[model samples]
Target: MLRALGLAVLLAATTIAAAPSASAVTRTAVGGGTGIIFRLKPTPETPTSYYICTLTAVGRDSAGNLVGLTNAHCFIDEQGNKLVGERVYRDTSPAGTAFSPAPIADSRPDLETGAIGTVTYVSTPNNLLNSGPKGLDYAVIKLDESRVAPTSTVGQVTITSIGAPPANGTRMCKEGHRTGLTCGKKLGTNGIWFTHLIWTDGGDSGSPVVSGQTLVGNAWGAQHSSPILSIIDAMNTQGGVGAGFHLAT
Candidate 1:
């Protein structure tokens, strides 16, 4: 089995590298309630390296293309470099045996349901140092609708609306492929740096953070993020209007 603590440390130390651009394609947007764990494999290398992360948010860009959200660190490696044309795969079974041909009960990403996503947008690590810090540590992945099931279809979960940023002691919860339905009180201001007092481990990165039914933020390193609105604003300014990505409702 993979060690969460070790993997967590490696993720923190890794940085992203530039990837060759691919022809732009329209992605099918998905709504919240998608808590599938997926694997990311960097390409053009002889030996493949894999990282596990969760799908936090799903939606379409301005052009009505489907997209998903995750953490930028998922695309980074210990070498402090990023991979170009990275491919994402859905976990067809339990976290420990996702690649196995055998199946488990309630195991997702089976023949009928699986998702393939390509890394699209990721927040710059420099945000922590920039004069105007945005507290962003997120990424967006464009999904292939034909292969992946929407959140509404797989589970009745949906991120209908985005709630205000979290404040200290605010109650929040997260759904992850590795750990399902863990909730706790937040530890910081709603619009500032905040960490939930929830239980989170390595693969939980990219899981959605929520307060009640409202969307809050995607999991950072393990359980952290800038304000939820701050991340959205960064996407607007950096991702531009064409990205057209937003929380549902």
Candidate 2:
């Protein structure tokens, strides 16, 4: 829903039952900085739609379910609506597949990596909550054990723990799928965003905002960020899909 976000689309409602992905490789790491796919089908007989976004962090919930984080916008539509049955896949695009108006001709349903997670909890313009992204826009993804090898590192940045929002003038960095690794100073405010000046773009949604090894903020759009520490508190308070989350190390 933000200006810097990209939307990857592939709609094939006619395809019944996705075949098992023979090409679905076991990802050594599906934590922060990884590229992921979100798929949705209006009905069993309708076409499935897929979108692309970046994974922020992966670990487990209080229930011990393997889970990850990203922006809720990735699973929502232009009208600020969420697809009821969105499923997540490991995006294998070498160049990154940020969403645009038209579906990428090659961006077919990539069951190749299999479905790794489903959106367990989310916050978007359509469904903002007391624990939602109004304070920090984010989504909680429950990862499938079969499709991922969990780790805490986002690219080269190791997320050892959650941290407070960086001071306005503090230094920060992010590992985005589209922008790769970029760093800048904590700049703006007046909004829930940490407001870093780092280089961000579409498809970089949910990229990890880190201060050294401490996970701090989450990239909201191309230019805005939200506090990961705040999101964790919100998720736990919601007592839903991602309640009681812990970062995997």
Candidate 3:
């Protein structure tokens, strides 16, 4: 039997309070869940480098194609440095055995455990001046076809159709690399404005926030004013208040 990896101790020094707080929410089974964990591997010349991130399995886009959603900030830094997309891995257990990008053909890692994926589309950060700063902090990535075979651990993801936000107090959930799986509830929503009180943390950024098959939002900024400041909704334009963009249907 394959064992899931144990939760790693979060680092206090780099931890962000804006993330959801820890909780005892029941963890759902992996295969039909909402999130997938991916680890970015550094090249031999960059052995000291490390990169890991999470993604939400949003429904299909406008064209009816499957798409995975995540925060654009998760892929790059404020300085425009690529933070994701070198090579990624998913752990099979806490023992460190992982399914990473294979070095050659025919020797590929088993997909039933987990397989590698690639960063397909990364959105440019448009400052509020263009549309307002709260715009969608989201991006779309394409999993490697061979790695994403029917039997792969990171199964196909679906992009949600745009629609009205979920009612207040509705249940929500997310899958993340660091936290594994967690659940929460909707606190409020108005137009593109949304706020949720999920139990996520650092490495939890870029996680997709979903309500059922609908892609509600992505984890972007945390409230600095509250105990667990809520996740702010991405504005439509760069600066104006509106809902973030989803895969065009």
Model 3 vs. true fold: TM: 0.51
Off by over 4 Å in 1: 1-49, 94-115, 126-135, 152-157, 190-192, 221-223, 240-242
lDDT per residue, candidate 3, 91-166, as tens digits? 3322111133211111111224333444555544323233434434455554443333321133222334334447
TM-score per prediction, in order, is 0.68, 0.79, 0.51
For model 2, how does the per-residue alpha-carbon lDDT over 1-249 read when each residue is reduced to its tens digit?
463554665554455456455564645557788877665445322336556678888888888888888887776776667654567766655533223222233334345456677787767531222344454668888777766778776556778888887778888988876666878898867465667777777667788989888888788664678788778888888886678888765
Model 3 error, position 15 (Å): 27
Return the TM-score for candidate 2, rounded to 2 decimals: 0.79
| lDDT ranking, high to low | 2, 1, 3
- Can you write out model 1's per-residue Cα lDDT over 80-145, one digit (the tens) per residue? 454434566564444431123122232333222333667766565423333534445667777776
* Whole-model lDDT values for every prediction: 0.54, 0.69, 0.38
Of 1 and 3, the candidate ahead on lDDT is 1
* Candidate ranking (TM-score, best to worst): 2, 1, 3
Question: Candidate 1, overall lDDT?
Answer: 0.54
Q: Which ten residues in a row have the lowest lDDT in candidate 1?
A: 5-14
